[model samples]
Target: MKAISYSRYGGPEVLEFGERPDPKVGPDKVLVQVRAAAVNPVDWKAQAGYLDTIFDTVFPVIPGWDVSGVIVQPGVSVTEFSVGDEVMGYVREDVLCHGTFAEYVAAPVRTLARKPRNLGFEESAALPLAGLTAYQALHRALHLRSGDTLLVHAASGAVGSMAVQIARHLGARVIGASRDEGQDRVRELGAEPVPYGDGFTARVRELAPRGVDAALDTVGGQVLKDSAALLAPDGRLASIADGEVIALGGRYYWVRPDTDDLTALAGLVEGGALTVRVAASFPLERAADAQRANMEGGLHGKVVVTVDHDH
Candidate 1:
């Protein structure tokens, strides 16, 4: 099968499009014909060796985790899904090879969920990782509840956008912080927009004088610090981007592949409580370009790589 891979850790320049061996299906896995895969910053960061200490890298690694595809074959022990099932997953394995940026992937059942019936493959592909991250952070780590006031940093980006919508669905009053250009989008996502940069904390304070009831930080460094300060006393805080959040009395979260969580996100999508915005897409062969596009930042939604089986 043709796939995008890199034999060594490097930038987009190291990625190559070529034929690679098809994955072997395990008893708890299914072989999926790839329809679309979403690019996350972690994809390129893992390719660049930033996560080497945390995840073992197999040489010539395929570099994607979020997928929306159809099941071509289910493993011998699989019973949850069968051939022809359309699914989406955050297909991160314990290791760093055999990823979704290929014609096919052998995805474990734990990572799979039925795709939202209301969305296309590209939008479904965009939902898993970012959606899971936001869902886990807001629902699990922060324990956000109705009537609570929540502040989401980077509120117009992929995960942050999901956070805003999910928080609103949970009946929270959302205050979203973004750049000036993304403020309108943040507001559209049901958050009161607060611009970042100078006076960011002050701006948030003006909206919630007692500080917010909870704060989610998608941007690290100074932004994380500001988020901590903006939290109301006894407020919950979580950060997917910075471990330093722990030092400031917040949980540092890493998204996990959980079928239950993905299913919940699909529920939100089908119910019209959640929507995915796809900012850009590239063919599978141009996955390196997709990675570069995601790395360039300033995108309000996901950058996706679509697979064409017709060719």
Candidate 2:
């Protein structure tokens, strides 16, 4: 099968497209005929080798984590899924576990969930990573509830966009922060948009004279520092950016995928409680271009890589 990979981590130039041996499935694993896969920040983190400490290093790695496809075959021990079943998953591709940059990739049954019936392969592909991060950080790590006010930093980006929508669904009054241009776009997603700039915190405090009930910090530099002070005494905070910021006194969040989280997200999409937006799409051979767009980071929504299969 033809796929894109990088023997070394650097810029998009490191990505090379070529044929690789088709992955064989292990007992408990399902071979998914990958219809589409979406790019996340982590994809470039691996491509650029920035996660040396957050994760173990491996060479010639394939970095995609969010995948949507049809089950072509399931292992002998896999009873949860069968051929022709449509699924999307937050797959944890262990280093060296070739990712969804190809025509097909093998995934453990535990990582699979029935794809949202309301979505297409492209939209389904966009959900697993960014959506889960938003759901977990808001409802799980941050302890949000209805009527509480919430602030989401970088709210126009992938994870941030999802965070704003998920927070609203959970009954929180969400304020989304992004650059001046992104404010309008995020505001359309049921959030009060704030500009992320000098004195951004002051702008946010003005939104909620009392204080925000919770915050999901997707852009965690000074943004998180201010979140600590903006929280309503019991207000919670969560971040996808990995770092020990205990000095700030807010909860630190690192996304962990589970079958239950995937199921809940699936339900939300089906029920029209959550929405997936696709900013661009590229064929598998153009995986390099897709990664380039994600790396540059100016697109309005998720960047997806479409793999070919007879769906």
Candidate 3:
């Protein structure tokens, strides 16, 4: 099948569009006909070897994790889904290869979830990783509850925007930190917008003088520190961007593929409590461009790569 891959760790220049061997289905997996895939910063980072120490890279690696597609065939042991099922997943395996940027992917059942009935493939593709990251951080890590006040750093980002909506849906009053250009977006996502950079802590404190009940740091570094200090004594803190969050007495989270969590996010989308914005899109052959677009930053939503199966 035709796909985007790189034989060595490098920048977008190393990515090539060509035919790769089709994946074999495992007993616990299904073959999905790719419809769309979303580009995350991690995709480019991993391709650049930033995550070399963490994951073993197989040469000619296919680089994508978020997918929205249809099941063409299920594994012999599969029963949770069958042929023709529309699904979305954060299809990260233990190793780097056989990813979603191809015409098809052999996805493990544990990573699959029914796509939100209300969204298109591109939008659905955008949800799994970013949505799951926000959901797990707010619900599991932070234990956010109704009436609590929450602070979100980098609130206009892919994960941060999702966090704002999920926190608000959980009934928390949200204060979001972003740049001046992103302030309106943060407000639209149901958070009171606060500017980043100097005095970020002061801005948040102005919104919640007693300190927030919890804080989610998606920007890391000084933002993580500020988030920890802004907590209301026992306030919860978690960061997806920085591992130093652990040293600051907070959990540093890395998103995982969980069917249940993805399904819950789907429910939120169908219920109109969550929405995905597609900032840009490219065809499958141009996936390198998609990665570059995501890396360029300043996007309020996701960069997606669409697969054309009609041919």
Q: RMSD, each candidate, Å?
A: 0.7, 1.7, 0.8
- Off-target runs (Cα >4 Å) in candidate 2 are none
Candidate 2, position 5, lDDT: 79
In model 1, where do residues sit more than 4 Å from their true spots?
none
- For model 3, residues 170-287, the per-residue Cα lDDT tens digits are 9999998999999999989989999987777887888888888998988888788888889998888889989998888888888899999999999999999999999999999999
Alpha-carbon lDDT, every model? 0.95, 0.83, 0.93
The alpha-carbon deviation from the true structure for residue 131 of candidate 3, after best TM-score superposition, in angstroms, is 0.4
Task: State in Å the error of residue 309, model 2.
Answer: 3.2
Instruction: For residues 1-311, write the lDDT of model 1, one tens digit per residue.
Output: 99999999899999999999999999999999999999999999999999999898888899999999999999999999999999999999999988999999999999999999999999999999999999999988999999999999889999999999999999999999889999899989999998877887888899999989999999899999888888888999999999999999999999999999999999999999999999999999999889999999998889999999998
Residue 266 error, candidate 1, Å: 0.5
**Candidate 2 lDDT tens digits, 43-109:** 8876776777657656667668889999998988998998999999877754544777888888988
TM-scores for all candidates: the values are: 0.99, 0.95, 0.98
